[model samples]
Target chain A: MLKINSVGLTISAVPLLNNITIDCPRGSVTALMGPNGAGKTSLLKVISGEHKASQGEVEINRQSREDWKPAEIAQFMAVLPQSSTLEFSFTSEEVVALGRTPHATGTVRDAEIITAALAKVDASYLAQRSFVQLSGGEKQRVQLARVLAQIWDHCECEGDASTDGILLLDEPSAAFDLAHQLMLIEIVQQISARGVTVVMVMHDLNLAAKCADQMVFMNCGHCTAVGTVSELLTPELIKKVFSVDAEVITHPVQGTPMVVV
Target chain B: MKVLNTRLITPRLCGLLLLIALPMVSLLGLMTGPVFISLADILSITLSGNGGNSQEKLIIEIIRLPRVILSLLVGSLLATCGALLQGLFRNPLADPALIGVSAGASVGASLVIVFGSMLTANGLLLGLSAISVGAFAGAIITSVIIFRLATSPQGTSVATMLLAGIAISALAGAATNTLSYLADNDMLRRISLWQMGNLQGASWDRVGLCAVTAGFLGLLIPREARALNAILLGESEARHLGVNVEWLKRRLIIYSALGVAISVAVAGVIAFVGLMVPHVIRLLVGPDHRALLPLSALAGAILLVAADALARVVIPPAELPVGVVTALLGAPFFLWLLVVQRRRT
Candidate 1:
């Protein structure tokens, strides 16, 4: 499990996260939703150990985040930002192979894993294309392949039941087309089925409602609500937090709460 | 089934071809000069270490050998530095000299040329090579300033790095000009020749120093190839891939500066070897640092040796400064690269 205990973060004397606390269990896909400037990316940065919480602590698998070696943590967890600002022209497959940096290099198994990860995202055709030449959505899917390859072999809980590899994505579907977005949902579902914890920052509420096992609603750097889709995706909460009027009704197909704005 | 169509093959072939080409160029460099030593004489002297006339032997061992070795050594260092900074800044336009290290280093060298003889007479900067020390310090100071300016919360912004380079270059250029104005006739001549860059000053000791430093850098730089590959993906993304981004940045900066510092100290700031060699090599092979770093080093060696050889023959009796040749060649190529980038973007 990933545990955040009253975590507070400040960047340049401006607080971005205030006393944030949450628990993310294994084999779950949690969708983090917030408006712009809602500290979603900052919180993901903190969880990935890219940023530190000034007031409280974060733990992974019951051990403090600080206690884990970077490599040790990396072997089981991966993070993908909305976009990678890579300057060089690495082939898409080469970009995917970098996910294996935390693992090993020059092994046939790594090649298999890389190809398989790209196949999972339907990005196998892009493998030979230059990453720099790819379209924005194509690049995002390539990066998705990278993170998937990072934690692909992490199927077993090392010592704790909650120790399955966790994947944190900041606005993973922000640039994705409808097909890729739906493909991302299926990919996340399959990854979760293999006992991985998935925490994704998502901008589209409908995708969150339809695809996520849980929803986390945030506003002004504070997580306002967190629960199952039915419990949290209420019209009142959406109107209050998102400043939008939406009618919450059961999805005719999946029986989950659907928000119609 | 094997994944034989890996990215590894082309670079491997390129490296092999480069390795095969390097010796031929070096031998060509060894053979050419005013003396017109026969190929057999060059080979026999090179292999046996003692043959031909004593004067020819002296020419081979003391005069020509150090220049050839120095060119290769300095070339590798500068090219590797360029390759590194390109990766660090995540921009193809980010040359090692973009931070004004070369200009600042030249200023340090100019100061040494103007006042160094007096210092030696007074024995003040004792047990030290004044020019190298000054150049190294100047290069390092400029690099550190640019590094500090470029790094921020949003990560190392390209604008800050480029702006700092321009500001520092202008400042250092003015300073060096002032020093040149103040220099005596003899000091002015030294400053002028040194500023243009000369390989005629090559010595065994300087060759040894560069050899060791360049070897260390050549071996050590490839180790960071994996981290550099990720760093090319940006700092945060590299970190997400488990690279220690801060540590990687520090190592790359220090080593690149060290490489440039030594090259400048030895070679009076040869322009564009760092910028041109890596870019040309990158275009040919690809931008994978594992390939870029080592191939850049080899290609750099080839370019400098070839340039030095041409420097000897182009104006036979009196050698044109190697820096002028590199700049004359590099400036146009660099402009062409910019044009190509502009079109692509």
Candidate 2:
């Protein structure tokens, strides 16, 4: 379980995140939804230990984030940035193998995990290609595979009920095509089903409705609403949050809320 | 499996080729000098200490051997430092010289050259001459300033450091030129020659200093190869991957400064070996530092030894400075690499 206790962030005397609190339980997918400059990424950074919260603290698996060593936390917590600045000509497999740095699971086991992770994102064919040569969508998939490989073995123990890992992503679907986005949603579902806690910043409302178990809506650094898709996808709430007039209706096939603007 | 094997084979093969080429090039350096020594004679002298004639033995032991060893050590240090800096900055064009360390060292050496007569004693700290100590101090100070300028609570900015480095290099260059202007005729000649970077003054003492620096780098750097590789993915990304990015940056800057300082102090400023060797090695083997670091070191050793030998033989009676030779060879090759990379992009 990951808990954010009234977290706040102020950078250079300017407030970026207000007293935001949320709970992300095991086997759950939580989507952070907000407009531009809404503190979604800031909140994600605080949870990942990239930025420290000025007012409150974050707890992962019942331990304060400060108490855990970086190497220890990295074994179970994997983060994917929105984009990468990796300019070197490392092959895709080599880039993915970097995710295995925190574990002592020898080269053979790491290779197996890398291959499995790549296949999960449908990027196995690009394993031998250079990362710099890949298209933006392909690179995003490879990066996803890398983060997956970081926590690949965490979800193997089946009997335990506690959370095995936490995956943090910032705009993971921003560079993906329609098909890859769907594939990513499936991968997130599969990983969460294996008892991994996932927190992601997403833009597409209908897509978030399709995959997310809970949604947290934010505006101007404040989290305004937290509920399930059926409860929070009202047209009035959409107008107040996104400032656009949208009609929320039930999906014909999935019976979930669909927002049409 | 096929792809993996192919990726794995290239580095191994390149490593083996470099290993083979190192000894051959060292032998070539040993054989070609003012007095040409034949291969058999050189081999016999090296293997059996007392085998050759006394003059040949003296020439080999006193003059050529130390020079060869110094070139190897200095070359390896330069290239390895280049690889480390490039990895740290995440810029392919980043070189040790690009960061003002070399220019700073030049200013330090120039200071000693112009003002040495005033110091009553030529103080030796850790077996290094006063000039070397000055150069090392200058390099360290410059790097510290550049690092401080680029780093804040937000983290180090690679672009800021690059710009700061250029500014510092210009400042150091101006200092060096002013010293040159004030230098007398004899002092002026010494400063100019040192600036050109020659191995003609190679001694057992200089060789020992370089050997120690190279050994220190060899032991410390390879351990950080994985961290260096992680850094190429960006600082925050590496931090997420469990690397302490701040610590890694500090350690890399210190190592590069030390390596470049010592090289400049001992052999003046030899350019392009640092920039060219690592790049070529990266091209041959992929950018995996586990392969790039050691291969770059070997290739650097080979390039310098060969270049030093050519510097000796290129001019019949008078020898050209090894720095001139390296710059002449490296500048065009670097331009070619730029063109090729541009075309590809």
- Candidate with best DockQ: 2
Choose the strongest candidate by lDDT: 2
Write candidate 1's Cα lDDT for B1-345 as tens digits: 112222324888899999999998888787777876777877888898777888888888888888899888888888889999888878876777787788889788888877777654544232226776788788888888888988886566556777888898889989989999999898888777877777777888888888888878777888999898887777777787788887787788889888888888777878788878888777667798888998999988888888888888887888988988887766787678657655643
Which DockQ-derived CAPRI band holds candidate 1? Answer: medium
- Angstrom error of the Cα, residue A215, model 2: value is 0.3
lDDT (0 to 1) per candidate = 0.82, 0.88
Candidate 1 structure quality by residue, lDDT tens digits, A28-48? 888889899998888998999
- Flag regions of model 1 displaced more than 4 Å: A155-163, B1-9, B120-129, B144-165, B330-345
For model 1, which pairs clash? none
Q: What is the interface root-mean-square deviation of candidate 2?
A: 3.1
Where model 2 places Cα greater than 4 Å from the true spot, the runs are A155-163, B1-9, B120-127, B153-155, B331-345
In TM-score terms, which candidate is top?
A: 2
Q: How do the residues B135-228 of candidate 2 rate in per-residue lDDT, one tens digit apiece? A: 7777878888888999998777778999999999999999999999999998898788877888886889889889988999999999999989
**CAPRI rating of model 2:** medium
Q: What residue pairs are clashing in model 2?
A: none
